[model samples]
Target: MAGKFIVIEGLEGAGKTTAINTVARVLNQHQICDLQFTREPGGTPIAEALRNIIKNGLDNEPLTNKAELLMLYAARIQLVENVIKPALKIGKWVIGDRHDLSTQAYQGGGRELDRIFIETLQTQVLGNFKPDLTLYLDISPELGLKRARSRGQLDRIEQQSLAFFERIRQRYLELAERDNTIVTIDAAKSIAEVTAQIETTLNAWLTN
Candidate 1:
């Protein structure tokens, strides 16, 4: 059987890192070992370079919306082709910190880009490829930003207005509602509560 691709998605400060670790443990308990963990726009050297550009705003001028979208896709394509696909081919499960859904939520919704255009890009680049399961940790923008700020100085994307993240949150909900593979998790609760919920959800998914 082909290896499964599981993606964990959310805005900054949604505890995706912790959730990913929990997911690896849960999957191992289910005998799904040989997992490869990856994050976008990274997982490979080229992708990491792109990620720095996306996050740091190191460019002399502000990145255009279209340019930013293309760069994200470029990074994703590199990671998928070079790292994720190769690992999965060898029967290794891939656990991704974020995926294309992020582009839909952040760039399409938060940046106010046209959804249809974004969908077209996805189709062209990914073709029917998608994660077998996605866990979306949902949290309000204000609370999420508060947590993110506590970590350190915010990056370029992380520094977006509260209204931008609110739109991203709305888009994520809308997409999750339409997709059966996407499971929404309430991330406002305590860490223990969130971990328990994630474990339960993963167990149920494995059972099914």
Candidate 2:
């Protein structure tokens, strides 16, 4: 049986990682099925190295909007071929911390890169692979940055101005609206509340 694919998406510091972890734990407790949680950019060795470059920095001009999109898909292809595909071929429920939605949010939304180009690259490079469901954690960039700051120093992308993040969040909302598979969630609530909401939604979704 093909396993379910669940992806979590949001601006930096939106608590997507925690949500994905919690969802996996809940599934395990119920013995629902094989559950696995992972992140992109560094899912595979080659990709992880590229991930470091993206997250850290390049000595030259910061990655251009188009270059950023290309690097992302480069890492994505690696993630899918080496990590995600093999796991899904079996019965493992794949819970990803982020996916193509980031392309829409970060590259398309944040950088104002070419939308047609991004979509075309996705179709050509990624092929038919896509998440079964995406959980979009909706939160203001300010609150999200506050949380992120509490954790540690900001990375390259995180260090970008609030205006950039705001654009990214808006793009996320747009993608969620256009795609039925994407479920937008108000992440302003407490972690427990958000987890409860997700569980309730998933339970309903799985039954039908």
Winning candidate number (TM-score):
1
Which residue runs of candidate 2 sit more than 4 Å off their true CA positions?
Answer: none
Report the lDDT of model 2 for residue 139.
Answer: 96
Residue-pair clash count for candidate 2: 0
Model 1 Cα lDDT, one tens digit per residue, 1-208: 6688999999899999999999999999989989999999998999999899998867478889999999999999999999888888889999999999999999989999999999999999999989999999999999899999999899999988999999999999999999999999999999999999999999998998
Summarize candidate 2's per-residue lDDT along 1-208 as a digit string, tens digits: 8788899999887888778877787677668657766787778888888888888877765676677678889999988888788888987889998899888788888888888988899999888889998989999999999999999998888999999999999999988999999888889899989898888767766766
When superposed on Cα atoms, how far off is each prediction in RMSD?
A: 0.8, 1.3
Candidate lDDT scores, in order, read 0.94, 0.85
The reply for model 1, stretches above 4 Å from the true place, is none
Error of 2 at 161 (Å): 1.1
Instruction: Enumerate residue pairs that collide in model 2.
Output: none
Model 2, position 194, has a per-residue lDDT of: 89
